[model samples]
Target: MTLIDPRNRYPRPPFKTQPQDFPGLSANMGPEPDYGLDSYQSGERLKGLVALITGGDSGIGRAVAIAYAKEGADIALAYLDAEEKDAQNIASSIEAIGRRCLLLPGDIRKKTVCVDWIDETVKKLGGIDILVNNAAFQHPRKDLLDIEDEEWRCHFDTNIHGMFYLTKAALPHLKPGASIINTSSVNTRTPMSILIPYSMTKAAIANFTVSLAGSLVEKGIRVNSVLPGPIWTPFIATGMPAEQHESFGSQAPMGRPGQPAELAGAYVYLADPNNTYTTGALLPVHGGMPQL
Candidate 1:
């Protein structure tokens, strides 16, 4: 196999300061995030499986959905209604690959929405073998004093509560050999002071993954998390403060932000049924950023 240099493989940061409303669209991003549309190679690692991914219309979720579809898995994407255009783009690509793609548009913060999406996936896709809790919400504040109760609750509702609701609703459909992958972050270890609420939710996700893994092991279900570092996603372009954009990922030891495509393989690995022994792992793909 050929190797690509990690540092210079994708676009480096010093990015343009382009901000958008909450839940930004990747298509609007300058130097749009590479979701492996033309790059990732597929080996059918997840063939004959159905996977549901929240936030699957863009960023890391988009990359993972594309990768999984390429690998022969039917995909179900759960994203916000505002991201219709982005969701449609992904659905078209998956359909072109001859795999089924289900677009579920709703706010995952609501338990009803979560349950509906899970039920829809099972009804349409037959069954779900992989569950990816990747949708998240984060708004940075310069100081904790500036953070409001609603802002803090928004982070928890979307990031942590949504995961819980979706996972609980999916539990019935997730049989033996099913894989549950949550999108945690390097913030779990090194909480960013400015993103207190977001960081706290991430830490909770890490603990949730481990505890849930243990709880599901008896049923032959496996749970794990992918803790990504400074990835070049719409989240960076919109969720962060404008002043931070230019040096968005400069703090990483590699001197660059990681592309969403770069994290696809980690998700695939954890979901691959062949790796039965691995569970409750918090795999970090942070461009050599020190999480400790």
Candidate 2:
């Protein structure tokens, strides 16, 4: 399908058609074809499972939601109110795959909202088999002293605090074989000069994953984290400066940014019941970011 921006004066190309080939086109492109349309195919790995994912409206969350649907699991999607349209679209896509999708719009930053979201997911889906704590926000700061206390608090509230709230609320419903997958960042390892608060939260998420996994092991619940290096998502355009967005993900060893589709497989594997031995593990999907 051809996705043209309404504001653009020129015609947009079809999905999966390379941008390089259409030099004359000057439109604000839609989602990369690989993430949105081309690369996602159902695999039924999580048949009969139920999953609740925060930020399942767009980007990595949307990719994971579609993947989970394809894997034969029902999804309860939670996102901020601003993303309701995107979340509904993803719900429609999940339904097209013969899976049920429930959309819950709220801010994960509020403890009460987090509790309610988890409660609603359990009520709608019966019980949670996979809990994905993936909602996050970041504000870039160039100077360390320029960072305000409010921004620091907001970072913790959105990234780490929300995860804690949702996890605590869902723990009661998550059964012996349930899995919790948190999204960390490559910036946690290779700190970015501009995103101190964001990177700190990601590092804390890594630690939280480890501690949660250890605590849940006796109960048979698994917790693991995925550290994504540089994936091209709406966050890049909305969170970073225009110059950074123009060349986002280009610095990776792969010489290109990752599409959301590429990370969905990892989430499926971690969430699958068949693989029960792994927990408290950190999987780095950073286009070959060094390990040492």
Global Cα RMSD, each model: 0.9, 7.1
lDDT of 1 at 175: 91
- Quick one: best lDDT, which candidate? 1
Task: Give the count of colliding residue pairs in each prediction.
Answer: 0, 0
Q: Write the per-residue lDDT of candidate 1 for residues 159-209, one digit (tens) a residue.
A: 999999999999999899999999999999999888999999999999999
What is the Cα-based lDDT of residue 97 in candidate 2? 79
Task: Kindly list the per-residue Cα lDDT of model 2 for residues 43-157, writing each as its tens digit.
Answer: 6889999999888877788888889888899999988887766776778878887999999898888999999988888888888899999998887888999989998898999
What number of backbone clashes does candidate 2 have, counting pairs of residues 3 or more apart or in separate chains? 0
Clashing pairs in 1: none
True-structure Cα RMSD, model 1: 0.9
lDDT of 1 at 76: 97
Where is model 1 more than 4 Å wrong at Cα? Answer: none
